[model samples]
Target: MKQGAQGSAATGAGDVPGSAVRVPPQSRGAADADVDVDVEVGRERYDAPGGVRGEHTHSETPLPRPRPAVQRASVRGQIVDALRTALVAGELRPGEVYSAPALGDRFGVSATPVREAMQQLALEGAVEVVPNRGFRVVERGRRELAELAEVRSLIEIPVMLRLARTVPAERWAELRPLVEASVRAAASGCRATYAEADRAFHRAVLALSGNEQLVQVAEDLHRRAQWPLVGGPGLRGRAELVADAAEHTALLDALVARDLDVVRALVGEHFRGAR
Candidate 1:
């Protein structure tokens, strides 16, 4: 009976030796290699607050890393964008020869891309690519601008008037955001923003016609018309842009009210006054 008692004491409550102890793998010491792997993968570990010494409970989360610099894939596309902006801003003067190499140096790029982009602009009639020479910005003096205004008025006015009379009021309501953008651009005297807003407004208006061809023609002409007047704000100054933006507001107001007479008057004034 005494020997049995001793055996029971040795085997009871983990007193038998290492083979009798029971513990979960998680409660064991964590490996330092695991922490290093987590940190290397942009993961962070944070322990719970006010915990016991043996309680190594932790939470792991992904941390944000620094983003690498991005670059455009197409040098030609970049060259084209820069050339068009310069052309529209009138930075490239009309009736002057600008060589591809010179323009390439100005843009800090190679001549090949510049030449390629100028070829596209040549097709747009914004520039003329001369044989053996570089290129020349087409002279768009006041008369040309006036003629462009006349063409736009001819195409856009009638379509806008028709849509005002027929299109649903809700459809026209969508123009509010675009008009607001124009107002902001005008206030800032940013020619590029104003151009974008103006283009969006006119394109949206023409789209209601259901004639894709007409919309395409009008938008193309709009881009060309915008390219000529590159100084401060085209024709006048910042005030003109503000005034132009106001005309857009007044026109929308007339459209919502379904007042054809007012719309006609506003459209006529907008195109004529711009000229």
Candidate 2:
């Protein structure tokens, strides 16, 4: 994460020369910082219905903060993550081709990492490589999603059950960050954040098996299941997302307790609701 003078990049509709704007993690350019930027911060004044204007100033309104940019090889993973969230939210349409160079430019990074990320997406079956053109999103359907869920269940559940029985409670406790991320994302109704956090949680859960391939396959299936939800973010309301986020907490509970019956039930419910 890049740390410096944090501002909201409030570049009005061509109103200001250098106003703060959120960049994807570390995608901010020196050009953006070139102009004299004024970020309205700190004090907040609210006028009441029947009172004088600027009468009350209690606390500052929470403005959207700038997202940090990542580094080096991590940028590839970040790009993949950004693309996945965009895919889930239907920002990238099916059957339409997007070039690696263009996407790299869009992300303010090099084509190499963007291409590498696209290759990973291709492995996940989220996109297909189109010869000289680029990658196109695979049209995901209900049948495809169900099959992905079934495969994930077959691969992930048995190993997860074994880990629940064998792994120590402290190990499960280590996953609190991932769980908390999902909780925050769900509460904020941010699909991109929730999806990435959900990915991290499931991948962390499967990593206990100590099988790299197992974790990879489970993550791939997880991504596939999420991409085609037509109105995915809209459909998953705060309430539904909160309930979904609770599952991670509940799963952790069962794992720590070593409750085989509850673990098994939760595992089943996870896949069921995932579809």
Candidate 3:
């Protein structure tokens, strides 16, 4: 499965500047060229509501002197998070031109923050700036994504194994609620919610490993995989959901019991389905 499968480009309808755009080079080698994302992101233009333009105002009634920094930081954090979610959800696709004006309109803010957010995304390798075009999506190919999955497994399963050894019996008590959330969300037919819950379950398992960096990398890979995996075909069926729930159960059991082989096999099975 391709990681973050949506084409990473966004189109701004010619209103944004070219220098603001960045295009990532295609990553797939010869074997994967036939894969194509038919989904288009900017087909219809969304206009701002009448008489309201995209701009932000510093709160005028603020009494505290330190409030300005806090407010600015808060808004900046929101903008960056929104942009990241947009990219991960395929609200933007690769090679599409991103118009700061259009995004500002959609986000109900002025172009400045939109521009700043794009820059931040670019720095994170989430989006790129095109020399002559506005922002475009970064293209991640199938093989590359698969390789990333392999790297993730390498980092994750061992931590799970070590975690199996150290976590006290009482701490094992915490995972059931997360597992229950996965079951319920799966039944509810919300793939996003289910996936998040599912990720939480796995994360909880690894958290016991006591290695923060490894956990962090696993999380980054998982987050990077979200757009592709959720958007995949065969992702919405009840059987798929049930299978995932079962897998989570099996994984948790294996960890609690210190069953290394079961843990490895469960992790492998999960990634295979992802492909």
- What's model 3's TM-score? 0.65
The models' CA-based lDDT, in order, is 0.70, 0.73, 0.63
lDDT of 1: 0.70
Cα lDDT tens digits, model 2, 1-275, are 21124444433222322343222222235653323222322223231222223211234343554443455568888998789878877688777899999998899998889899999989878899999999998876667767777788788788888998899999999998889989998898766677778889999988888899988878767877777554333555667778889998999999999998898888778777773
- Point to the candidate with the largest lDDT: 2
TM-score of every model versus the real structure: 0.67, 0.64, 0.65
lDDT of 3 by residue, 14-65 (tens): 2334222222223355443323322122232222222222221243231222
Which lDDT tens digits does candidate 1 get at residues 122-221?
Answer: 9889899777989988877667777888898899889998999898888889988988888998898766667778888888888989999999999878
Sort by lDDT, best first: what order? Answer: 2, 1, 3
* Candidate 2 Cα outliers beyond 4 Å, as residue runs: 1-78, 100-105, 109-119, 130-133, 230-233
Ranking according to TM-score, highest score first = 1, 3, 2
